[model samples]
Target: MEKDWPSGFPGINWLGRQEEEAVADVVRKGALFRYYGPQSPTHVDQLEEYARTFYDVDHALAVNSGTGALFTAMSALGVGPGTEVIVPALLWVATVTAVIQNNAIPVLCEVDRSFNMDPEDLEKKITPRTKLIAVVHMAGTPCDMDAIMRIANKHNIPVLEDCAQCNGGSFRKRKVGTFGKVGMYSLQINKNVTAGEGGLLVTNDEKLYTRLVAAHDLGVPWKKGLPDETGEVCFWGQGRRMGELAGAVANIQLRKLSHVIAHMKASKQRIKDMLGHMEGVSFRRLNDPDGDTGPFLILMFDKESHAGGVAQHLTNGGIDNVFHLSNYGLHIYHNIRSLVEKVPLSPAGNPWSLSQNSDSLFEYGKGTCPTSDDLFERSVIVTIPSRLTDEQELEMTQAIKNAIVANVTS
Candidate 1:
């Protein structure tokens, strides 16, 4: 470790001693699996209940990973072969994979500063095959749910809120995931609520919850040791149950989520405010539920001015910044031209809209997302969300501004 870290270096200590103690107890007793015993609350079960109460949903389901939760939710929503789900083009690979893994075609939509799916773009892409609109609350900034919901409802499509990065974010006084039929949050080590590797799915619909539970638990629809208020249990969802240690650790971290989120927001704002209004840089927009902003700060660079190359300059100067790209943007299809060619649609509609033919443009293709294509080449990620003092945030902001504005002439 460096003698001194950059103030908020360690993000959130999502796993505390309480979690270790619980896990230790479980390990000591060798109850690593669910269905360990009756009258017992395995780490996973309590975590599910905590998620329900925290998100204010009727029920919660715990799983092995965020991807797992997404897959389960997609299955529960009946999104499968020949179906389509609207997903944003500026999120983690897991978001797109969840749709494709469910055997549904992921209709990639563009994102605005909020980094959430653009409702207008989403509506433009909806079709008879569109069964669910999966909105990823990117970088903890909420999506425009009012518009998203309006379009979704009008199209008769159930919304699946992918809140993997917005662990504690909300929309209009309600949790981010609560607004949709199903919501999923990640608990990876880098997440605001780290548990090494874990995920949770929440919903107000009993039937949906039952299905997710079965999906995560390997399609075994019966409740293990938890006391079922009703004797009858469904016969579905299997192998999605979280590990005992992950569950135990999550419980410890759950109590501190609110506090941790508050600190993260304060830190996040500092980075945003510092870079906001800076020449040739754009900050993400805030439209969804305002909770603890997630762990990372997303910045868009000006592609016309060679933003990607500028970002490379910052990296060369010992300042680290990351570019955000969707799975389809990076893995499924590396270039926008190929993706559009394969999709058989106007390139104007895809998330790669910024891929203009301009010589200065970030080379994706013509008519890609004006901002995204530019940002992909020039964007910067400050730091993974970490708790820090004022001085540290100031240093980061000042450094970013200096590098981005370096030799930039009007």
Candidate 2:
């Protein structure tokens, strides 16, 4: 039964002729670069246009990858040595790495039971130097944006929503990315929608949009199909433009996103219903269940040993990508060696040692976020593949039940 279970590559599972056709069109037209080529390139431009409508934002920018979007956004937001950026403990290493890359200190905010940023801890983490709040919508669930935005507004700080995992998710009735000043999404192969590798950024700020455009390209916004060096937003750019090849696929994939999310959400709901309730077994508390994108299901246990046992049992049963949250690799802060050790970017021993960052002293380790550390130790994360047949779902449900019975109930 386990052999029949699908691996959790969400968008890859749904790829077909549509993606192939889009790619073929780019090759046929001989327009590999997004800006210019033998034929006029429009795929990346079209993807951004469609993204604006889909995410309901005024501006959208396509980039090379999700990490590029983060770096570009942080740069446009004026993150530097003197500033601090608040981030949830349960985020991809790229989230925190963006802060460090920008020469800003990342203040770790504890995550509540939602497994997303804790709004209460977020407020406490804010300081006079706090320049941004990077809210990560993790594991297919939207964060508490209402509470997070209120805190950010009170402090007059900007929020950058990282929707890499929860691409189609919303909080309350609003989309996750719209709540922040700038929001970014990943189009990596494992994401809800794939371009194989691409990223999208959305924002309502016109002035900031110009900066984003410049920062993502050659440090100058494009004017009349050429770089406008005279623009006020000029600076050093990261050359993170999305190629036409990726844009072609991403354009079609963006259109299919809602359908992909709908299928995964329904499948997850059905599996959760089948599991029902069990003693000493619980699910992660969603801030808004209606808005969940549903790529992963998290089960909580009373003790770390129980979580470890269940994860091992499920893996032994041939379940793919099951893990005790503590062992979830770079997604957990303590596991990020570069961040935990304050590894400097250069021999200057800067960022941490610079005069501008001297006041923003902090430590990172297992004890830094005790609450999140506890949650990590006692939770089991299971990947919910994008497409699952009735039989596969049944097998998964039964396998989960058996694992819990063997580990928790005993």
Candidate 3:
């Protein structure tokens, strides 16, 4: 009999005494608040310290959520009205929403076979109003950071890396987040590491770090556990601070990230090797195979009908979390209703109709990116669980092969 397969909750599979003890210690110490409490709080500070070292960055800030980190980073990088931020089509809704939330226009760039920001399309999207390049490392794979950075440098545009789905992933040995001006990671339950819910920001620029710190909290940089009134960086903070409770769990989870990623990567590679080459199916291109965190496997088919048929066959064969790329919801650029319809933040008709943003008009929806649309219609994405026994891996491999043979070879 085949063993039961695990879901895509990578870090949760490894959770045990460590997380429990960490959380219990915080509760017992009465340090629920990160800044101050009955007992001196240290978990959030320690988490930031460890994150700085883990990502090899000069500074790291713990925030309330991945979305919060995006807003904070964008604000710090000067993404505001009249500016445009270029982003890949195959990104989470939050990535584009962040650009719009900053009162900036979001320009969608086409993703290549790697399912990452196509450096070529990214260049064509840049204009005089372009302010930031928001590169999202989608589905546990890093973008081509070298090519992206080269373009950004040529145009003097700062790059903000959205590493929410690809935490612990790297490109060409350098970590994904470190290559950009700032990198953001999510600690949500579905991420590689879980803190229940939290986020982190990392950067090497001291001035930018100061701005991020201020923007994420009370609009003033904190010094020695207190908000510094005389600080150079000050803005209207959104009050997005990570409490000690989340920090406690996130601190422990971050330590186990590498181990979790290693297990998942090994399992994914083994399954892919077993499948080999199917007549009509091809694996999504990996920019750096060794650098992939490996929580998802994207299979491209020659036809949309073949992909849909394969997806249904996989579901019937008990393969969990299978999705036809077009129906993958908000992850596809055209499926984001608010973006496609150009929904404004308020009734003010701002961001889109504002005088500053008048020249940056662009359309959204299905036909916005023909190249990406073709790829999406003919692709299927399968979730790769973090922990898979030998038997389970074999079962998954056979299930995928059987699905393809039944749908494509038939």
Candidate 4:
């Protein structure tokens, strides 16, 4: 018999009142468009205002997707042809997408135990063409800010944090997005704050804020009170505005994020501590976590030299929550277009390659990022995360140990 885990859905709230009225509210009034005017009841404007305040940023632009925020920000920042944006190969596809979307080259860099950018690798990758660095805090883990910032300052490269997976997470007491020049958030259904489908960009620089706002709002400052005529507008932009409904849901969810994050941290630590005791398997330790308590725990299976088992063992031991591909669960990368571009060597030296990348920073195949590749092959990519209770955590611990004892070979 299969064990029924209550949280099969990505972001189902058993005790959320804010989201309780979410569905009904959208269905009743149904003001879908965000640009209705001063009287407009759409929550998108309110959401943007609320996000700006909550995130402590000068401005927050809401958009259709978190990737959209990255794309829009890159465009406004002038990251296009001939520009190089540093990125992590181990991160989500969107991080690279933002760089390529702007027609900029993406120089793949390595990650430290914190799962953030490696400042050493970053230093080596920067060049005259380098314009930006899009760093993702893997699994809501904060990156080494002091190092990343120092490097960015040294090279004058603007950091665009792909914080889609880390909404309420922080770095050295400051919020993740605020640490960089601009930060992007995802409100996709599976994220901490779910609005079905949406994203937000945060910034403190007034000039960048103005540019992004104008670009996001049809090339004008056409928020709630602007006329639909050229007489009131001064420029042109594509319509990437998010509806009020998304903003409404995000507002209420934002309030509960801290509590949820706290719970997740507690839960993640429990797993980490338990897994750390295993002989062949160990949790990746880094300085950024303050030694413990983050949104999730990352355990790795040591290489063939040592005895270890990957997350596949979790399935045999009756535990099933890992992320090899998808952000939510056991999903894989399945973009069909990538097949045609297969190359034999990545600039970093991965033997497998793409025929043609959006930019040159991406190589054919040099078989680089071996650590990520090895871990990807043998890891479990656990996703039980910060939501499970102590009892549930214990059960998972037992299952993992049992799986490892039976599976790890000499």
Q: Model 2: residues >4 Å from true position, as ranges?
A: 2-4
| Candidate 3: tens digits of C-alpha lDDT, residues 1-410 | 23456767888888889989989998898889977666664788899999999999999999989999999999888999999999999999999988999999999999999999999999999999999999999999999898999999999999999999999998988888999899999999999998988999999999999889899987899888889999987778878899988999999999999999999999999999999988989999999998899999999999999999999988887777899999999999999999998997999875888899999989888989889999999999999889999988898899898889988998
Candidate lDDT values, in order = 0.67, 0.93, 0.92, 0.65
Error of 2 at 62 (Å): 0.2
lDDT of 2 by residue, 1-410 (tens): 55655659888877889889888998998888866656664889999999999999999999999999999999999999999999999999999999999999999999999999999999999999999999999999999998998999998999999999999898897888999899999999889998989999999999999999999998999876788878877688999999998998899888888898999999999999999999998999999998999999999999999999999999998888999999999999999999989998999785888899999989888899999999999999999888899989888999999999999998
Model 3 residue runs over 4 Å out of place are 1-4
Ranking by TM-score: 2, 3, 4, 1
lDDT of 1 by residue, 1-410 (tens): 12354433232444456777887888887888777553246777778777778888888877888988888888777876557677776767677666655545666677766666888888887876677888888766788889999998887889988887778787787778888888899887767776778888888888777667666764545555543445344444546678888888877776677877887787777677666686666765678426546576766655535455455555565654344332124422234344435342243443223232111112223335554444444555555436556776776677666667673433
Deviation (Å) of 186 in candidate 3: 0.5
Strongest candidate by lDDT: 2
Better of 1 and 2 by TM-score: 2
Residue 108, model 3: lDDT of 91
Q: How many steric clashes between backbone atoms does each model show?
A: 31, 0, 0, 28
What are the candidates' C-alpha RMSDs? 7.0, 1.0, 1.2, 5.1
How far does residue 286 in candidate 4 sit from its true spot (Å)?
3.5
Overall local distance difference test of candidate 1 = 0.67
Cα error, residue 260 of model 2, in Å, equals 0.7
Model 4, residue 178: C-alpha shift (Å)? 0.7
